[model samples]
Target: MLRGRARREQAAHAGGTPPADDPLDAAQERRVRAVLALGGVPQADLPDGVQQVRLRLLERAAKGEEAPRDVSAWSAVVASRLALDWHRAKRRQERLGERLAALRQPEHQPSGEDNRLLSLAVARGLDGLPDNQRQVLVLRFYADLPVRSIAEELGVPEGTVKSRLHTAVRALRARLHEDEVV
Candidate 1:
């Protein structure tokens, strides 16, 4: 699909008419492909994402904003930002699920107030950890992956993965104990 899009872009640049049915022009297609190649978005989403970029531009134009003077640059930025937003939203959803699960624990269930506090504390602890430790913890606990799997996924040694998880868990425990609210 990427190859086809690239071909179409090149063809457009070479004076061939773009696909009449395609929503995105050659430049927009190029920008969308560039954003996808940056690695967050899956290749399968190219067609829909390209169309969505065009639709987004159309929507902005409908708001009476002038067309961007540099369409390619603008499209690339918008597409990249949108992919980042999607990635963050997915992480937030996963974190919310983890917190909800923690809140549902038998010990925390007796008081809605306590559950809420514990959930918030966990979120804060997760956010406070260093990126390496937090990522290892998330892969270990949230993703339910074993140490070996996490090490493979993260391209690190299993010992490193375990070390990070242990440290992250310890830090979270300390934070919870400090709060005395959860």
Candidate 2:
């Protein structure tokens, strides 16, 4: 596959028109062949469609419609984005499958070490804090809210929010260090 791709690249660099017999450049043709040969794809699968899209992209590239001088870089970015989309779709499908499987199975309780030590420590530190300090920490970390948002939510000034967050963080750090020692 690599050799075929190399040959195609060489042909492309040679500046000859793509052969009438082979619609794709040598590398693209090899990629199509490799994808078809993979058992994962049925003969009628979208590998051919993907190849066609890639070829079109390449053709556009060759015609200088796209950044031809940085074709490889652009192609890499396109391929990476495509792969990321595929993975995200796959993950969504897997989550749906897991939900269906859970519906069919008996309810299962979680059984593991109570990993809430950090939570407990933080809670203890928070309990010892003034209400404003606790609110700042809860908004910033627990709710994942931004400082400006927290300030708006609490109807306070942004500087006040920053000050509270700073104090909360310092207190938490000291508490966490003491917890580690004990």
Candidate 3:
């Protein structure tokens, strides 16, 4: 059995320190909300927007983007950018869908016949990439951060970031072509 309150997370909004089941600190949530609001995201959509930021960061981390040292600040950056991306995606719904769908199939293959092959091929290629190259690609594409932002977050020069991205893309392209997915 477990013992001690140290193992449990403390809830901040509560009147006193109590164990909180929510993984995100109440303070961090506030930062995320503030960022979303500042980005012109609706107050009504704040929760969903914050959730989007959380999920995106987690997804990027899983895909190989390094977790930030300052999670609260990182979440703010992510929330603001995600809000922008959400608006952009909403503005281009039809065009984005067709383009995204096109990635899974060739000109004649049906869209639903398993677009996963290409995704799997890409995953395999990512696995083969060097750590630095892989991290840059995940940070740029999955986290949707710009080169400068990625450089700041990763503590590297922007030129280094570009080089890693270039190498990563070349490797993935070669892998995909070899696999005949491209």
Candidate 4:
């Protein structure tokens, strides 16, 4: 599967048009990819962004409209706009996820008083940790992300994530014990 993907990417960058129906030519596709990349779209998503630009161009052609006077420039502008839209959608999705998570209830409900006290202690302990350590802990535990995924998302090494998790957990545990809250 990966090999096939690699081949497709190579074909894309090689300036080869795959289908007769594709509205954007090879050079146009390359320009679209460059625009999207410089616009902050990740490399993995470039192909999809280029295809989106092509789709819009094709739709315009289907509508019996004259092709844009300069298709290359037009595609680049479209790709840039797509990149901005992508970031907006990503932010919106993240905000919605947070709101949904806040509304979610845990399957097992402990005694309310005990649960409240423990939650307070944990929140306090989390607040006392350094920002990096706290981020690692939350991503690992609350987000339920594996260490490797956290490292990739944060652009840090796995070892760094592991070390931060260990230090944060130890500090929080010590604080809870000291306060007799856990």
Candidate 5:
């Protein structure tokens, strides 16, 4: 129908997917949008709700079912249903995000004694590393020096600094595993 085509063109111009050859006429589309907006659907999602209603109407036609006796009323109901579904989905996402945030929080806060013991173990581990390895490790970790800066400060190539850092961390990890300090 000319009216359907015109509505599709208008939808296209408004940055929505044009419901090409849709069953809903212009007035019907307007009613669908109004119903969706009034049902608490956000403005940005109104076009999508309208498209859903149009798709359902076309789907009925595609299935060889008789068109609804009252197209406007049917579209309005469909739009309202879509709006409710959207709200339900939004609430579900908010609940899921809250659950994830709760999971990320620490269940038991570390005690001061635990932190002190860990710090002592780490200091002892550092003391056991070779001089060059220990120097680079301290500069990189404690002093928060980058690889390039470490190389420049120590007058060593960047690759050499990286190799030392890797070997040192491996050795320290092995030592910690052997001591059961971690």
Candidate 6:
């Protein structure tokens, strides 16, 4: 009886099965389910490669081949990496879908009085300014860029950005003030 029991114990450990009385079996199953759910890997959608990796990890745990202290840490790392990969793949699919939708839609054309008025105002303002001032104002306000970003985009220094912004603001304020008076 002692020999038979020993053989069974050895077999269980070698085959990666929990012993008949192992308390961790139920806890391990629950942990695996939670990890899979949190990683967004539904049983039906689990890829073969991922499933294989998870199974190998679980088998090692079941056989008491992996350290008890490291199991949770390893499991968490795997779950986090899987979740990150899923999110990246989902984002790519969303971007592709958006591109396809844009391709299917007709190009937008401005046709309203408001659009025309805005265009005319912009054109008149741009025409009135010197080229450098116009470029600065367009980069600063029209593009809604910060001074640092504008400087970087224009390959100029931050001081130049500040000066350009100050000059443009004064010019626009003067132009608007004159238009109001007229």
Whole-model lDDT, model 2: 0.63
TM-score of 4: 0.49
Q: What TM-score goes with each of the models?
A: 0.44, 0.37, 0.49, 0.49, 0.51, 0.34
Deviation from truth (RMSD, Å), model 1? 13.6
Model 6 residue 171 CA deviation in Å: 0.9
lDDT tens readout by residue for model 1, 2-21: 89988887677457345654
Q: After superposition, how far is residue 111 of candidate 5 from its true place, in Å?
A: 17
Give the root-mean-square deviation of each candidate in angstroms.
13.6, 16.6, 9.4, 16.3, 18.5, 16.9
lDDT of 3 by residue, 1-182 (tens): 25444444332324433245443566888888898888878789997886786686668777997877888888888887977976776655665566666654667774543467877898999999999999999888765568998999989999999999999999999999999987
Q: Give the best candidate by lDDT.
A: 4
Clashing pairs in 6: none
TM-score of 6: 0.34
TM-score of 1: 0.44
What lDDT, from 0 to 1, does candidate 6 have? 0.65
Best by TM-score: 5
CA lDDT scores, all candidates in order? 0.78, 0.63, 0.78, 0.87, 0.85, 0.65
User: Which of the predicted structures, 1 or 4, would earn the higher TM-score when compared with the native?
Assistant: 4
| Residue pairs that clash (backbone atoms under 3 angstroms), model 2 | none
Cα error, residue 32 of model 2, in Å, equals 51
Clashes by residue pair, model 3: none
Error of 6 at 3 (Å): 83
State candidate 2's TM-score.
Answer: 0.37
The lDDT, on a scale of 0 to 1, for candidate 3 is: 0.78
Cα distance off (Å), candidate 6, residue 77: 23
